[model samples]
Target: MLKDINLNAMNYFEAVARLGGISKAAEELGVSPSAVSQQIRQFEQQFGVRLFKRDKRKLTLTLDGERLFQTTTQAFRMMRDVRSAIQRQRENRHFNLRVSPSFAVRWLSPRLKEFLDLAPNWAVRIDAAPDFSDFETEVVDLDLRYGEGGWTGLHEEAVVHDLVLPMCSPGYLEELRALSDDPIGQLRQARLIDSVKTHYRWDFWLARHGVMGERMVYPLRFDRSSMALQLAADGAGVVLESSTLALDQLESGALVPLSTAFEAIRFPAYWLVCPSRHTSRRIVRIFSDWMREAGRVHDARAAELITGLGCRIREQSGRQLPGEEYVGE
Candidate 1:
C-alpha cells in the first residue's frame, strides 16, 4: 500500500497540513494553490478518507489526518537526519554547537578556545540564540543547554549544578550597607536586578533564606543573564544569578556575594544535549568528554568561590518556584 502511494502528492499533503492553508503551503513549495489542493484531494481519494475539514476558511485536521501528519513529520525528520549524516561524512571535522546567548557569552565562549586548541584541525561553529535547537532539522551536532533536563528524543548529560545567589558590585554592596545595618532590611531598599528568563529569581532566593513579606524593588529587567550580571557589576543593582555564569565577575572582584549568612540555591543548571544518533560519533564523543572535564573544573572553582564568600549550598528540588519559567538561561 505504501509503495502504491504517490510520494509527491503525499509531500504536498504534508505541507498543506503543516502550514494549515493551501495558499501558504503553495507559496512555500513554489507551486500554485490549485496544485496543492489537487494533490491533497488526490491523496485523500487514494486513502479513501477525508484528511482535512474546513471551517470559516480555516483548515484543521481530521482524526486520520492527525495520525498521518505525525507519521509524515517523523518521516521528514528522519530524511533530514540522513541528509545531515551524509554531509557530516563528507566533512566530519565540522562541529556545530548551539547554546543560549547568555551561556555563550558568559560561560562557554570564554572556555571554547580550550576545545579548539585540543582539536586544532576541526571547524567549529557556535550558534547562540534564545530558542532551543530543533535537532531533527537543525545542523547542530550538540547543544550546551542551561535548563532542567528531560527533553524527549535527545540525550541530556548533566554538566554542572550551579549555586544561585544575590551578587552585586563592591561599591553597590557598600551603598547597600550604608542604607541599613539590617541585612534583610537593606535588601528591601536596594535596587533589584532580574534575569527575566532564568528559572531562579530573587524572590525564591530571598524566601529560601527566610526573608519574606518585604517589598523588593526591581528597577531593571533583562532577558539575558550576561546583561544582568554586567548591570550588577556596574553598580546598578543586586542580581540573583548562577555562579557559573558570573565566574569572571566574581573572580575579578567586579561582583561580590551579598551575604554569606544566606545559603545559595543549587540546581542542575547546565546540560550537554544531543540526538542519540550523533552521540556515538567520534567528534561528538570527543567534545562531550572535553565538556564534562571542563564542567568538573568549573564546578570546583564555583564551589570554592561560594565557599570563599562563606555561603552555604542548599539543593533546590524539581518543584516549580515563584517567577520560574522553563526557559533556556
Candidate 2:
C-alpha cells in the first residue's frame, strides 16, 4: 500500500522543489498557487515527513525533503526512460492511416514532418480516401475523417473542429481596393471558387455577414481544397476555406481575411476514428496522442490570429457585434 501511494502528491512536491516555489510550480503545472501549496502539505502528511522549510519570505527544502527529492527525482527519471523505451519499441510497429484527399493535402501533409520527427521509426501507409476500405476487413489503424459524428461502431477523437471564412491573397485584396469603390461588395464581384465535396458555399458566408445577394459567381470549381487555395493565392478568386487550411498562408501574409462573417459549423471534427476493439496496439496510442497535441497547438495559434485580426477590424470599422466575434472553432 505504501508503494501504491499517490504519485500526484509526489509530482506536486517534485514540481515545487524543482521550481523553488509553489507559485512558480503552479504556473508550470497550470494550476493555482494555493492548490500547489495544499498538495505539498497533503504529501507531507501522507509521508509523515516535512518536505520544505517555510521561512517568513521563502521556501527551502529541509534535509529530509532533499533526500526524498533526490530519490523521487531519480525514480521519476527512470519511469520516464521506461516510457520512452516502450514508445521507441512501438514506433517501429506498422500501421495504416486513412484520410480524405483534401485533408491529406491541405492539413496533414504540411505537418507530417513534425509527426515524423516525433515517431521517426514508425511505418505509416496513408490511404487518401475514406471510400473503398473497410475498417473491419482492412488493416488500417486509424481513419482521419471530416463529417458529422455519425460514424457508428468506432471510437472517435476530434482532432479539430473548424469554421468557414473567406480568405484572399494580399495581391487580390490590393487589386480589389484599386479596382472599385466598394471593396467588400466588389470583392464578391470576382470569381468564386468552390469545393465540390463540402457544399458550404459563399452564400453561407455572405448570409452570415448580412450581405444577401446573388451568389452565381463560381467560375472555378475544384475537388480538392489545396487547388482552390492555390488559385486564391494566385489572385484567381476568393475562397471560403477552413481556418485550419488557411492558417499557414494567413500567418505568412499569403492570405487575408475578407470579413468577420465566419460561422462555426459543427461538422464532424477531423477525428482520429479507429475501430473500437483493436485500439490496444501501442502504435495507435502514440499516434493518437501526437495527433491530439498537434491539433491543440494548431487551434490555439489559429485562435490567436483570429482574435488579433478581429480586434483590429472592429476598431477600424467602429462597430461591435453581439455573440463571440468569429474565431476558428
Candidates' C-alpha lDDT: 0.85, 0.72
User: Per-residue lDDT of 1-329 in model 1, one digit per residue for the tens?
Assistant: 68999999989988888888999999999999999989999999999999999887789999999999999978987998999998887676788988888888878878888998888878889888877888878898988888878787789999877888889999999998998878787788788998888877776667666766647757799998888999999999889988888988898999998887667888788888888988987788888999889889988888888888889988876845543446668
Candidate 2, 165-278: lDDT as tens digits: 677887877777676657457555667787655535565555656765575467798767778888898888888777677777888878787655443332325777777875
Give candidate 1 misplaced runs (Cα > 4 Å): 1-92, 210-214, 322-325
TM-score of 2: 0.61
Candidate 1, residue 62: Cα displacement in angstroms equals 74
Worst ten in a row by lDDT for model 1: 319-328
Query: After aligning candidate 1 to the native by TM-score, how far in Å is the CA of 201 from where it should be?
Result: 1.1
lDDT of 2 at 138: 86
Q: Which number leads on TM-score?
A: 1
**What TM-score would each prediction reach against the true structure?**
0.69, 0.61
Model 2 lDDT at residue 20: 88
